[model samples]
Target: MNLDDLAEKAEEYRARDAGITHEVRVCVAAACQSGGSLPVLEALKAECDSGGTCKVKGVGCMGLCSAGPMVAIAPKGGAIPDSILYREVKPEDAADVLASVGGAPVERLHTPTDQPFFARQQRIVRENSGLIDPESFTGYVAAGGYAGLIKALSEMTPGDVLREMTTSGLRGRGGGGYPTGLKWSTVAKMPADQKYVICNGDEGDPGAFMDRAVLESDPHRVLEGMCIAAYAIGATKGYVYVRAEYPLAVQRMELAIRKAKRSGFLGSKIAETQFSFEVEIRLGAGAFVCGEETALMASIEGLRGQPRPRPPYPAEAGLWGYPTLINNVETFANIAPIITHGGEWFAGIGTAKSKGTKVFALAGSIKNIGLIEVPMGMSLREIIEEIGGGCPGGKAFKAVQTGGPSGGCIPAAHLDIAVDYDSLKTLGTMMGSGGMIVMDETCDMVDVARYFMEFCMSESCGKCIPCRTGTWQMHELLDRITKSKGTHKDLALLEELCDVVQATSLCGLGQSAPNPVLSTLRYFREEYEAKLTAE
Candidate 1:
């Protein structure tokens, strides 16, 4: 399909939708589905079919996961935020919901859109998440889905795309915060005839579902972003490596690929241009290490998922010894927007070094638990108190863990710090895929350190002694301290092990495995000291 054909498709879909007076959207994403959204969806559909100007459809996550099964009703061509939202909806509420679509909203079921949980988010990656039917290709097209790819193909050259990316200052969202434009340029400059682009969807971090939500909610958006990356970097083939645990995400992404291929967006001569790229889905065995780029490529090659030391990184040598460009689900999801709105427009948001927005999954003791995206320079206090609604039951906020098993926990003393790549590093943490688990006053810091250490020890690939044995040793010492069976020597020993593991580890998993222990000790050392037995 050419530019004109794409526009015609979008117009046709919009024209068909214009006839409807009201639309009812049900959150059918995994979170809401588990909360019984499917039955609600079917019930709403039955009511809409019985007779009304109302149409019912299934959408992706609405962000307030605790409030599901959520429903939204909107006027034709209206935005989702302005829609009448209903929380914890039941199947029997369908008739009342449909009846009150353009009339008075069901007061008992109504959820205010003006709440901080919904209003505070700056959605770039999740802009279309709760708005469209994820499985509908025409629905995505009508929402201006692939316009960025078509624009890149018909108007801009490869260098121009690269330049736009550079101007946008987008960083890799899969942690490490590497510049996206630099990585793409490196892959594009490679002298190989065969190049590959891989999207890392193995989101194994605890309390993190940002990637899964993006993949399931706006599968076409990811595909369109991948297509844009392929065109810019001259990649003929690509693979999305998602863990088997995310069945819904994999299913939606697979369906999106098929639809795009049928519409001439994935096969030979995409958009009727010289750019031709094909994408496939590769299921991971739920190995946490495979979230690392090298290990992800190894899994794609049908080998044991493990990380090798990097110098010849994925951008240099990857996937069958050819140049490969690897980016996480969120990084690619930002591509279309950057291309559509120039890179400078994106650079205008966020901080000086870290531009664009970051999507975070809020969990633990927070009252408003769900997915959210905010600008880079947003303070941790703002995220926790304002957006997350602080801790539940008025318990004082104690600390929050960032970056999952490989990250450090920030105590209440540093809550006002800006959450950028550099600021997090200064606090002895890195943004490892944007998972934030808040803690309250009752939590024991020593146990929190042990818990994450246990997770790392279990997930260790055992390829390196530092990660394999070091994590185990750290866990044991923390366990002893928590039980009040360890002396001062044990605390000193734990500190030394953290140093060794951080300095001598083979991969990121081993290296950052000491973060929880170190960060907790740095801020809450009194907890460990109080637990220690007399020498």
Candidate 2:
């Protein structure tokens, strides 16, 4: 389709929802759904039916999931729409919520949209989330989707597309912040006739839900980004490796693939050009190691998921030994915006090194637990205090753990630290797929270390001695220390083992397994010492 035709399609979709003035939006994403959003949706829909003037729309996450089931009211058509949230809503409150559709909002149920939880966000990847229905292909198209792919295919050369990405300073959001453009260029330049693009959605971190939320909320955005990557790398086929546990995400992505293929946006002769691309879905069997690219490729190829040493990386020789480019769901989700609004625009929004935004799954003891996106330079204090609303029960904040099992903890002392890649690294942490779990004063630092070590131990694929045996030993020592076992020598042995495991590990899973233990030891050594018996 041509530019005018695409624009017309967008307009056609836009008109369908825009004409409805009064609307009730319910958070139908996984979190809210678990918190009883479906019955609430039915109630709201019934109320809307009775009123006839108002409409009930089931949308994705609006964040603030701790207070779900959440409901919002808004006027549909406007240059800028105004929305009011009702948190902890139930089916019984549907009538009262409906009563406020075109009128005054219920005071008791109202949550100000202007709160820092929502206001502080810069939603590049999640822009369409909660605003459009995820299952509705037309709703996505109406929201200015697929325009980026069209622009890339019809107007720009593949080289031009790579240059745009290079200018954007976009880095992989998947634990390692590798430069995105550099990887794409490597794949594009490789001498492989069968280049492939893969979007990694197999997020298995204990507290991380950023990728799952993005996939469930906006599958099209990820697809568009994947398509853009395919075009840039001269790949005619792609795969999205998502976890089987995320049945909703898998279902939505499958539907999105089918819809996009039917619409001529994906698969064979796109926009009637020489380019033809197809995308398949590969479901991971809940193995954390498969989140790594090599292991993920192995699982996709029907092999046991285990990481091999990397020198010939996935870009050099990947799935089926062809040149492949792999980026996570969040990384791909950022592509459409980068293409639509030039790379310079994205580069301008974030810090000098980390461009655009990072999507984090705010979890643990925080009061406003949900998915959030903030600009790279935003401080941890802002995220924890302002957006997360601190710990519940008015408890004193302890530390926030970023990067899951492979990440470290930042004590309250470093709350003012900038949350970008470099700054987090300085704090002995890495932003591993964006999981920020808050801890309160009541939390035990030793236990925390033991907990994460246990997770890493269990999730270890046992492919290497450093990760398998080392993690097991660390967990035992941490468990012993937490249980007030005898000897300061245990502490010495744990520290030495940490160094050995980190230095000798075969893959990222092994290399970074000791981060949580080491970080807690660095800041909360007193806790470990207290747990030890007198020598």
Among these predictions, the greatest lDDT belongs to 1
Tell me each candidate's RMSD, in Å, in order: 1.1, 1.5
Highest TM-score scorer = 1
**Ten-residue region with minimum lDDT total, candidate 1:** 46-55
* lDDT digits (tens) for residues 374-429 of candidate 1: 99999999999999999999999999999998899999999999989989999998
Candidate 1 matches the true fold with a TM-score of: 0.98
**What is residue 137's positional error in candidate 2, in angstroms?**
0.6
Going through the candidates in the order shown, the clash numbers are 0, 0
